[model samples]
Target: MTQPHLLYVAWGYPPCRGGGVYRALATANEFARSGWRVTVLTAGRDTFEQYTGTDPSLESQIDPSIDVVRVPFEWPAQDADIRTYSWLRAHLPQVWHRWRAALDTVTFPERGYGPWRAPLERAARRIQETDPVDLVLATANPYVTFAAADALFEEGVPYVLDYRDAWTLDVFSGVTLASHRSRVGRWEDRLIARAREIWFVNAPIRDWHADRYRVHADRMHVVANGWDPELLGGDEPGTETRGAAVSPMTVGDGDRSHPRFGYLGTMTRMVPLAALIDGWELAKRRGSLPPHATLSLAGYLGYFAVPDPEMLATIERGRAIGVSYDGPVPKQDVGDYYSRVDVLVLALGAGRYVTSGKVFEYLATGKPIVSVHDARSAATSVLDGHPLWTATESIDASAIAAALGRGWQLSQTADATQRDAARAYADRFRRDRQLAPRLRVLRDVATTPSESRG
Candidate 1:
């Protein structure tokens, strides 16, 4: 049987260094493993390395047979590697560039990605001309990727949309997107309506789209994120032994005296860092936490090179309050960080629909989890049966404080039996296991009569 050719469009892929990239990489590899020839379309390596930073280790996980095409994307606002910008754009026309960046958000919800529509559409056309695609799966964040998919659809090609996060719904705010009636919203509605399938990360998000587009409910599917076994299996045991000596990275070195509690992902505005700080202070005030309990945060801030001043301020304040703001840890050292920490902190914004990718990794660690989000959060569904998790109903300082205390107690005394049970729970969420059924469905759909000619 010949494998079907699939064009996977994602703005971020391996080396892009974002949470969504993991899912995109895993999905592409999983499709390839299931006898599909996958070609990933993304921004060029230079742009990726200069703006978002790269993870060379992540490339090891990509299926060797899969083809990836990276096109040049110049987001002047996100270029930290000064060499990326021309002299006129860098020094002479800096004001105009900044103004244009500010206007981009108004043009489209995604700041840097909005202006990428033309380039992405051109790339899709070129790919189609070079190799006729059997199916196209476009992942969203720039949401503008849908524009490329729209082009393919117009050309009688079938496409699926993978919504790692919803565009119209503000998951953190738990509100219908204010721009739901705007031009972009209309585009999203039309795109999803025409696609073969629309993939969401959780049930709540799936339900939101289903309810909004009742006619397309049958097309909506849930494809949750899970731990990558290859990466986990290849990881070394100790966090301290894995990273560069002088690098601004810290991991949970399994030291009971100074046990590190790590949060390994991007530190965004949506994360309730204030509650984390309060909880740490409360643990100190109650004198219940271990003397050396320190929270190590390892990930980028803001979008790409832009740092959120408010979020940075909160991190600095957290440092004064006993939380160590260890800078971003590379993808290769993630497992070491997890191994060093006795407990993991899952701090997220309030939303029953927001089940962050980090939760799966936290579950995979087999360490006690301190969930600092609303109990009604979609993450609760995943951690509900897990034994070592202490989840709170609210993000209140006191509530988080209590949960932290319980998590601390769990860490201090969980037996091997309990730990093993936690590990068993995590085993259920391995990427291959969780995605197998969904991949099968996509494979079937790709070969179905309806998917052949749109």
Candidate 2:
């Protein structure tokens, strides 16, 4: 069969360590592996470095057959080093940013990335003209990529949308960020009206969109984010880390001394670090946790790799109570950090739609997990039946402390059987498994007549 030529639009691709980058990377490679000629459209090198720092090591994961095109993107607010800024941007930063935001919206409604529509459209049109694009799959956070897909669709080319994260709906708070009558809502309606498929990472998100736009409900799909088997070790049955469960009574070995609890992944302002720190202190005071139990926050403080003095100060206050910031670990070295920690902290903001990509990685580790977010999270569904999971019913320090105590207990007692079960449960969420059906669906859609898809 002649391979389908797919144009995959993702603003953040390999090297950009943004949360959604892995899914985007996997989508591109998965298409290539499924015998599709994939072209990845993303921001240039400078955008990653100046905004979200790049991970050059991640490039190794991309399939050689796939073509990656880096288009220029300017994010003035993220350029922390004032010296690198132009005169107007340096002198009147607020005015420059306001002007830029206004200019960006001319192409689309999204801020920071709306201006990318023209560049992406031009690139897509040129690529399609050179070698006809069989299908266009655009992933979004900037949502402006929808404009690129819309541009192709205008020329009678069919397109799909990968809603990596919620747009008009605030995922963290599970609230309507913009009404359907609003500008963003109208754009979403117009885009979905023509999309062959609209993919969301979870059912709740997919259902929300489907319900909101019932006229285009059949086009929506749920594509959950799964762990990278290469990074987390492939689905080998009966693995050591596979079925172990955490015991509540015992803490750690006498020789090891300190019981290690680590939170791995981006440490953004939304992470509820203050609550975590306060909870750790509460746990220690209530004798639910050992005095020497170490609470380690490991990973980049923000999307961009720059240090935040204020955030650092927030972490620093925890030092007196056994909390430490271990700094960011690279993607390649992430497994090493996982190996060293006894318990994994799935610290996230409260929301039914907020499921961090890190959760799957935590599941793969088979380590006892302490869910630090509200129990109402959609993540609860994934971790609910797992034997070694401890979750908070609320976001209070007391609830978090209680959850932590349970997690430490689980870590202390969980044997190989429980660990194996945890790993096995995670196996179902391997990236390949999650993407397989999606690829098949895409293939079916690609073969459909353009008019039928429209």
Q: Best lDDT goes to which candidate? A: 2
lDDT of 2 by residue, 1-454 (tens): 6678899998888888888888898778778878899988888977887777888878887888999988999765666677788888878978998888898787588887777788888998898889888799999887988888888888878898999778888898778988889888899889999888899988889888888899889888878888775554342222454333221122235333478999988878888899889999999999998888998898888767686677899999999999999987778777777777888999998888878889988887877999998677788888888888988878889998999999888887888788878877776777667788878988977777677864
lDDT of 2 at 451: 74
Error of 1 at 162 (Å): 0.3
Off by over 4 Å in 1: 79-111, 178-181, 234-257, 306-309, 449-454
> Which digits, one per residue and each the tens of the lDDT, describe model 1 over residues 1-454?
5578899999888888877889888888888877899999998878777777777778877888999998788775655566766766767776767776676766455667777887888999999999978789999776878888889888778899989878888887778874558776778878888998888999999998899889999988888898775565432212343321111112234465676677878888888887788878887677757666788877877656556778888878877556877777767677777777778889887878889898988887778998988787899999999989988667777777788888877887887788878877887676666678767877776677653444
Question: Estimated TM-score per prediction?
Answer: 0.87, 0.92
Error of 2 at 36 (Å): 1.1
lDDT of 2 at 146: 84
| Model 2 spans > 4 angstroms off | 81-93, 235-256, 449-454
- Candidate 2 whole-model C-alpha lDDT, 0 to 1: 0.82
Local distance difference test values of all predictions, in order: 0.78, 0.82
